[model samples]
Target: MRILALDAATEGCSAALIGPDLALSRFEVAPRRHADLLLPMAEELLAEAGWSLHDLDALAFGRGPGAFTGLRIAAGLIQGLALGADLSVVGISDLAALAAGARRSAGVNRCLVVNDARMQEVYWAAYDFDDRDEPRCLGEEQVAPPAAVVAPAGEWYPAGNGWMAYPEALATVHAAANGPVAAIHPHALDIARLAASRVARGDAGSAADAIPVYVRDQVARKSA
Candidate 1:
C-alpha cells in the first residue's frame, strides 16, 4: 500500500511517500513558507517515486495543536489532494508524530511531546507504545503553561521546540526525564508511518471529512 503524508504543523514543512519498497521525503524548517512550499514538495516527492496523487492509496496530514495557520494549511492541502484524487485520508496527531520520531531516532519508549505555542504556553502530550507496539497517548493533548503540563510518572524523553523555548521551566517540570531532543519537529515521514497503520485497520476517513484540530479555539487573543 502506498501512502502520502504531509505536515506543516510547526516551523517545518514536510512531505513523504511510502511506497512498497522505498520511502521518499522532503523536509525543511521554513517558517513563513509552508503555504508556498508544501505542495511543491509533495509533487516532487511523488515525481521521484514515479507516481502521482492518483497512485496513492491514502493521503495523510498532521491534525494539530500547534500553529493554527500551519495546521490549516496542511489540512487544506490534504483535503484538496484527497478530494481531487478520490482517495481516503487520515489525520495523524503532531504530538503522536513527535513520539514516533523519538522512538525511531533514540529508541525512547516513553516520550513527552511539546511544541511551543507562543503566549507563554505549549501544546503538549505524553506517549508510550502499547502492547501492540503502536504509540498510545497517555492523556488528552493539551495547551498550557510549561509549569502546568502534567506528565505520566516514569521516565520520558522530551522532544520538540517547547523544550528548547523554555528549558528551565520544562526542566523544572520534567527533571526526571532524560532528554531535550528539541531539534525534532513533527515530520510527514512519521505521519505517513502512523497513517499507514491506521489505513491497515480500515480507519481512514473520506476526504471531505478531513478537519484540522486546533486545540486553542480562538486564533487571536482579546484585548486584556
Candidate 2:
C-alpha cells in the first residue's frame, strides 16, 4: 500500500510517504510556519521516494481537535492533493494520532492523549491498544478545562502538551504516574499507518470529504 500523509496540528508540521518497502518522512516543531514547511516536506518525501501524487493509493491528514488554523492547513492540503491525484482520502484524529504515538514511543497499552486547546482547556481522549497493537478509543473525544479533566482508572500515562501546559491543574493525573512520560504529539507517519488499515478496509472517503473535526466547536461558541 502506498499512502501519503500530512499533519500540521499543534506546533508541529510533518509529511510522510509509506510504500511496501519505503517509508520517508520529515517533522519539525515550527510554530506558525506549517503553511510554508508542509508542502515542501511533502514534496521532498515524494522526490526522495521517486513517486508522485498519482502513485499513491490514498492521502491522509491529521483531522483535528487541534488549533483551527493548523487543522485546516492539513485538511485543505489533502483535499487538493487527493483531488489532483484521484485518490481516496482518510481523516485521522489528531488526538488519536497522539495516543498512537504515545503507544509507539512509550510502549504503553493504555494512553490518555490530552492536548492544550488553549483558553485554559484541553482536547482529550482515552485509548487502549488492541491485540493487534492498534489504538482503540474508549470514549468520545472531548474539550474541557484542565481542572475538569477526568481520566479512566488504570495505570495509564498522560501524553501530549496538555500535561506540561497545566501541570498544576492536571497534577492528579500526572502524579498518578505510569512513569514520567507525558509528552506526545501527532505525526504524519502515525497518521499514514492508521490510514493504511482504513484504506485496506475501503473505509476511506473522496476528496471532498477531507475535513477537520473541531471537537471544541460548541465549547468555543459557548465560552465566547
Off by over 4 Å in 1: none
- lDDT tens digits, residues 1-101, model 1? 79999999999889999978888889999999999999999989888888978888999999997888898899999998888889999999999998888
- Model 2 TM-score is 0.95
**Alpha carbon deviation, residue 173, candidate 2 (Å):** 1.6
Candidate 1 minimal-lDDT segment of 10 residues: 174-183
Overall lDDT per candidate, in order of appearance: 0.88, 0.88
Query: For residues 110-175, could you state the per-residue lDDT of candidate 2 as single tens digits?
Result: 888889999889998888888777888898899899877777788888888898888999998777
Superposed model 2: Cα runs more than 4 Å off: 218-224
Steric collisions counted per model: 0, 1
CA RMSD of each candidate after superposition:
1.3, 1.6
Model 1's TM-score against the true structure: 0.96
